[model samples]
Target: MDAVSEIPDYVKRISFIDSNYNWDNERYGDKLQKWLEASSDNRLFVACYDDANALLDGKPFVSKTGGTWHRTYLMQRYLKKKMKRLSWNKTENDSIIYFTADNRRIQFYSRKNPEQKIYHTILVERNGYIQSVFSGTKYEGMGYQFMGRKVYDMYRQNSGSW
Candidate 1:
């Protein structure tokens, strides 16, 4: 396995919020920093645990992977369950979150099985504090996917990603 895959499940989740965000932020932030800076060799580990707990408790998901949101086991489970009822051709029957390198696409993968060979796409747009989401299928003629193109035309007459 790769080095990243070797990290414990819990340690895979980490959040590095700036210390100047809110009340008691300093104390909490300092504690987090201490764990993160515990040792360079295991830095990712400490942060992952800290971030995982924070996320499980309802805080925003954070990651050193440059992702805007983190995905926990619970969230993954929930997504998987939701996907079953959504009627999308999914090959992987597990719940997964996909965050790209450029941070342009943040996707939640709902699989019908672990292989995730095929699935639906749910697109979401986020501003500073609000998020707008849309869902669609992979095949337009199949009626299982979203008719994203039709929705786009209502607003703009130009071509869309759908």
Candidate 2:
């Protein structure tokens, strides 16, 4: 499943850090550097796109905030590993869908237990990477808990963007 090409044309483009464009090179570089260095846990995982026109396009990146560094780092690492393990395949067993909020359409994919219909992992896709990730065990039911709401709120407060 080629996620990039599969993105619908209607989604807006947002820029992110990559080999050609580093996060430090953007207008918010100084603040981003300070944020990234302050605490490892205070971060928001975001998806990016190379061609979309929204504020989160380009390479997937993490935004810093006033949260627990270790947990965020662990979640980021875990999501990355899980995404890699899934091979980006979206089939009936692995559901991929989109929803509109704040005037933007967001893409999400979920890995669920087939027989029980319980989700193990849910990830937001941006620039072909996992932007936001949520996971739960079958014992916990299907409700998904977002990891970095505070970080994301801080981003909205500072950047006037989402």
Over 1-162, each residue of candidate 1 has an lDDT whose tens digit, in order, gives 123323343442232221111213223334433333343322210001223223323443444322312322233233334334322232232342332111111123321223312111222111100121211112213322321333332444455555
In the range 122-146, model 2's lDDT, one tens digit per residue, is: 1221212223322111221123233
Candidates in order have lDDT scores of 0.26, 0.27
For all predicted structures, in order, the TM-scores are 0.20, 0.22
Residue-level lDDT for 2 in candidate 2: 23
- For model 2, give the 10-residue run with minimal summed lDDT: 118-127
Model 1 ranges with Cα > 4 A deviation: 1-62, 65-69, 72-74, 78-90, 93-122, 125-150, 157-162
- What is the overall TM-score of model 2 with all chains considered together? 0.22
Supply candidate 2's per-residue lDDT for 51.
17
Cα-based lDDT at residue 121, candidate 2: 22
